[model samples]
Target: MIEIEGLSMDRDGVRVLDDVSLQIPDRSLTMLIGPNGAGKSTLLGLIARLLRPSAGHVRVDGLDVFRAASDAVARKLAILRQENHILPQLTVEELVGFGRYPHSRGRLAAEDRRQIADALHRANIAALAGRRLFELSGGQRQRAFLAMVLAQDTPYLLLDEPLNNLDPRQAISMMQVLRRAVTDLGKSIVMVVHDVNCASFYGDRIVAMNAGRLVAMGSPKDIVVPSTLRMIYGVDMSVHEVGGARIVQPFS
Candidate 1:
């Protein structure tokens, strides 16, 4: 389990994250949802130790995430950020191979090769393994990056707006892939997503934030209610049950 206490962050005197405390359980997909500037990404970064909190403690699996060795943290979790400065010349396979750096140390062994192959397959990008990143579409590139993170084989994965630049079909595909990662691969995922309906259908839990604080966190049933949607997004939404999943329909 991941435990957080009194977490806060301030940048240039603007408190982007307030005193937030929550526990994120393991082996499930947790979706972070909120309006822009709600600090969803900030919390994700803090958990990955990419951004240090002004105050608080984060412990993952009983290890201090903020104080642990960098290598140890890398091994324990992997985070895919919003922007990446990638060498566009690198092939998809090469990009995925980078995830093994924690285990391979720049030289890939047979086991590393096996992992790379598995990640490519899991990400549904094996056929594109030989293709350079610059040659793929935005959605394909996103999956390539996901494959890299998967190749790391960490128990925890954090993603920021991972559905960026994808069509509806592609986004659903990505969610399906992520769900499998949680169930089949035994990964615990926390992702910042704008699509509440997608979160409702796929997330094991939904974490809602607003103005830099957590407004609510619970199963879709707890959060997909009209009142909760109003509190988080300040919008009128009617939630419906479709095929056993609650779908949030927003209208003025």
Candidate 2:
């Protein structure tokens, strides 16, 4: 489990997050939803130890995330940020292999190779494995990055705006991949997403933030109502149940 206590961040005397406390349990997919600049990504960064909190603590299964050894924390949690810019010459497989560096220390063993191959297959990029990163489309490149994170084999995965540049079909496929990771592989996932319907359909729990504060958190059924939508997005929207899923339609 990931426990966050009194997390806060200030940049240039401007507060980004304030007294945020949250517990992310194991084997669940939690979607973070809010408007832009809501500090959703900032909170994820703090938990991943990419950013130091001004005053608070984040513990993953009892290890203080910010104080733990870098490799030790990397082994427990893997993060995929929104912008990943690498050498365009690297092939898909080679990039994914980088995820094993924490375990392999530059020399990949048999098990590392197997995990890389499995991640490639799971991300549906097995056919593109040999192609250069620049040769792939935006959506395919996103999948390649996701494959790298999967190959890391960490128990917790933190992704920021993972659905960016994905088509509708690709978005659904990615969410399904995450769902299987939770149900079958017992991984915990926390992601920032803009699509409310996608969060409603796939998230085991929804965490809503606004202006750097956590405003609401609950199951999709509990948080996908009209009032919550208005509270988060500042828009009036209609929510309807369709085929056991809640769909959000916002007004223009």
Q: Pick the candidate with the highest TM-score.
A: 2
Candidate 1 lDDT for residue 147: 87
lDDT against true structure, model 1: 0.91
Q: What is the TM-score of each candidate against the true structure?
A: 0.95, 0.97
Per-residue lDDT of candidate 1, residues 79-135 (tens digit): 998887899999999999999999999999999999999889877789999999999
CA lDDT, candidate 1, residue 168: 84
Clashing pairs in 1: none
What does candidate 2's lDDT look like per residue over 1-252, in tens digits?
999999999988999999999998999999999999999889989988999999999999899998999999999999999789898999999999999999999999999999999999988899999999999999899999999999999999999998898888878888889999999999999999999998999999999999989999999999999998999999999999999989998655
State residue 107's C-alpha deviation in candidate 2, in Å.
0.6
Tell me how far the alpha carbon of residue 197 in candidate 2 is from the true structure, in angstroms, after superposition: 0.4
Number of clashing pairs per prediction, in order: 0, 0
Candidate 1's C-alpha runs over 4 A off are none
Residues forming the 10-long window of minimal summed lDDT in candidate 1: 165-174
Model 2 C-alpha RMSD vs. true structure (Å) is 1.0
Q: Per-residue lDDT for 132 in model 2?
A: 99
Cα displacement (angstroms), candidate 2, residue 205, comes to 0.4
